[model samples]
Target chain A: MLSTQENAIIIEDLKKSFKNLEVLKGVDLTVRRGNILALLGPNGAGKTTIIRILSTLLHPDNGNVFVNGFDIKTQPQEVRRSIGLTGQFADVDEYLTGLENLLMMGKLYHLSRSVITRRTEELLKKFDLTEAARRPVKTYSGGMRRKLDLAASLIAYPPIVFLDEPTSSLDPRSRLNVWETIKKLLNDGVTVLLTTQHLEEADFLADTIAVINDGRIIAEDTPGRLKSRVGKERLELVIKRQDDFERAVTVITGNDLSHNSAEKTVSLAIENGVNEIQGVLNQLAESGIEVDTLTLRKPTLDDVFMHFTGLKPDEGRNEAA
Target chain B: MNSQLVYKKAYWMAGDVWVLIVRSIKHIYKNYDQLLGLTIQPIMFMLLFRYVFGGAIVVDTGTYVNFLMAGILVQGLAFGSLTTSFSIATDLQRGIIDRLKTLPIASWAVMMGHVTGDLVRNGLQAFILISMGILVGFQPTASALEWIVIAVLIVLFTLAISWIAAIMGLLAKTIESVSWLGFLVIFPLSFASSAFVPTETMPAPLRVFAENQPFTHVIEAIRALTLNRPVGNHLWMALVWCFGIILVSIPIAGYLFRRHGGR
Candidate 1:
């Protein structure tokens, strides 16, 4: 058992329902202090619901949750004092200038007016919003709005932060910029619980990835361990001709292989990376099965997702959308 | 010791409410179009009533403008209360309420801030409309004390209506739906009461409704106070309606806010 000081968040059999739909069915999760735990899942997998419950916005019908050693249900005010929430949407007043928004949040947190003024200036500079501090948020770009929202959350400098898909809607360049900002938070020893549908985001940023599906966390492990659990590597060959594709499929004896006739490619899950590729090429050469190209690929987060959920990531996206 | 803790809690709650009130007021200032509409609409109503409908109507009082003054002021307040609904609905739609809820501030502060902001705004509108009334041949015979009492009555009425508007904002699914819902409530109350004309001139059933409703009692209380008429049961009835609304609407709005207001 971990001490409360070492754990940033703990959920014991948390359950919630909206009408007849049970969004979070008896689930337990934990985040260690100063670590980033990414809730990696597709849409409507209850990722946002879990964040909502931990943030004290939505009440759980059953179970207990603790944030920074405070009970979420009984001591919500203390929990709020210890944590900041950045929701999926950037929740800032469009009519107010960026500086006013941060100052308002600071005041609500019970900071002194002088402290609010000082912190607002520091945060605006830190988030690269100093030039736009006096401009209303309605005129801000989407990325700028998100940056201001994040700045608002950090005004009080809480020990824990909950980010619900902080970069889900940003372009690639802005997404990378947000990633850098999150890394800086980690350097400050802030415990972060982030949710994202993008596999690369979880793989790149999360210390531990929790794969959730249908309101359940199917797998929770380090990114390396999760990927390795699915398999070692894959060998994919693009055959040059249609007749050779059929011959190549016949020569590869393993049942762990799949072929696409349109792409004229065969992908095989392999235990040995380099040796497996060599053996496959030699076998195809012997069978007069000409190969256009061959390459070895490591197991990606996508494969880990499919292995645990039994559904491709894109399929889950379509169903939820 | 217990009293000290209660005082401390009250102090912090007041602080939170004040901060949020400032935010709400800033929103009003920034949206100059809304500010303009608040001023322009009442002036238009005053002109239309003083010119178009002034000559045709007859009252036992000094003049038609004097009889129409209190009704116009109440009408402006009723319309101004809809801004409460619209602002609250916009906040909920934009997820601002959710952000406020997650903070460590008092839970009731958001609604209080919005309600208090409406009081300030409606008070200003009432002042403007009264000036317009005086300019258009409307006369008042009230003393200094009577003017103070009239101001208090107006404040209480605004508080009551603003709470109801807050409830509408919470219940309506969309901002557009909130306006439609507000119109459905405000249009009938302002029109069916003694706002635009006397209730005695109406037919049997309509006159009964027009005479007995809360708005009629409120408008009549203000009218009698301003015109130096005999103080009647209208004053007490108006107080009952105002307190009753404030008492009832507060809990329902608070309940809906806690249950569905997001975390």
Candidate 2:
């Protein structure tokens, strides 16, 4: 038996393979109670595989997973009782009304009839789906469907929830709406494990971010610390003339600068971006080099991701998405 | 786990199955056109065989319409149960099965719910065909008690075939494939058997295969029951076939349902 002090989820040396492709390779993760752990990765990086194993939707080839004090392999029913899963695609029945969907989930959870009714209303209202609650979900907008999916997961209020790319394929405004809904889960003290390829999503929503690549967690830390590992800030200079790029590179030397000849730009990692930009500008001005644009960029999760994975976060994602 | 906890879990599974059944039935109700189309096909077949082809094809039974009604009900129930495959395939495609698997209820509940719902729908289809048969100058000479037994037999046969449909739905890669698979099996079984035409009119080899199949026994049994004739060995054969299907398909459907995650 596990106590409440134990982590909400513990996965150790987890491995899974689908036919010829090895999806998860010896993954180890611990999500603390009442916190959000974002499994950040590009497409086919084993993020969904890991989420499926943890949620007991798919079995692992080897290793152990414990969710909310129960083993996922042997005590899957108990684990299921304690965890709610919102899959990548919305899982609510499109033929059922939004209210009926929630009620169905509540009944599946074995909640009493009266409690199911109350919770159904509460969740519909909480997700701001009260107006569309009576309509079949096929008539709902994409964002409404997502909200209903999330609400269905919360029907029983499980201590842990798995959001597998919950906001994928949604418009920007809808994505923000989902992000706000996820934020409310934090206040309710639910342990959330979300997967996303969106670096901005991880930076904004995750309390701890696990960077996965090639079926392994390459880096794991808070969003801020992960960004700091790459650099504090970036200094970007777009030279007006291609001829002046070589001279600008010399002035920006010793600052770990990289030049893109095609774009006529040079970027460098800097500790004090403002000071470094001023120094580079003065030096370039002295050499009679024209500058088109000069700016300091705060290090984003993309930089941290690239620094760890040696590939752009969006490199192999567009085709898959 | 404690016995009480196990009981509670079983109770939850039962409740979950009920919810899924209601959901499926409500979907069928909302798509009443599809239901109407399904129920109408058997009635049309009954009319075609009774009026259109009745004069040419002769059977030893008292009235050809009486002989055709039993086979029509069996064929209709078999075809009605095919909806189980289509609906299950749709649920698998839509990720509803994946969502249900993650819940605390028994995994078998998903398939059971589907079969149960199809069983109800099959019952309704049987009723519609029987009512139409009565309206078209057909009569059953069996007593009320035997009629009840015939109804029970139809329901049992439908329940068994539904398990097979569940397996097809689970094994199918696409929704369209499910329909094709159902057609591949149901069409051969219903047409080649004595559902529409008697086996004597067929060639000897085809006659042997048709007479030996489960659909022939079920149709023969239902024909005997409704005509107040001795059931002979066909009733036992029908019961055996129904039990055999349920015995073989329940485990296979459960395994395939578990295997086919939202893949």
Best by DockQ: 1
**lDDT comparing candidate 2 with the true structure:** 0.84
Docking class of 1: medium
Displacement of residue A162 (Cα, Å) in model 1 is 0.2
Q: Residue-wise lDDT of candidate 2 within A65-181, one digit each (tens)?
A: 889988888998889899888967438888789988998899888888899999888888888999999999999988889889999999998999999998989999999998998
Misplaced by over 4 Å in model 1 are A224-303, A313-321, B1-4, B261-263
TM-scores of chain B alone in all candidate structures, in the order given = 0.95, 0.96
Local error of candidate 1 at residue B102 (angstroms) = 2.0
Cα lDDT tens digits for candidate 1, B1-263: 69998998789888999988897788677987987797788789878887998789878776888988998898889888778888888888888888787898876688888888888888888998898888888889999999998999999999999999999999999999998898899888888998878878899998998898889999999999999998699999999999999999999999988877443
List the RMSD of every prediction in angstroms.
3.7, 3.7
CAPRI-style class, candidate 2: acceptable
Candidate 1 chain A minimal-lDDT segment of 10 residues? A312-321
The pairs that clash in candidate 2 are none
For model 1, what is the C-alpha lDDT against the true structure? 0.85
**CA-based DockQ, model 2:** 0.46
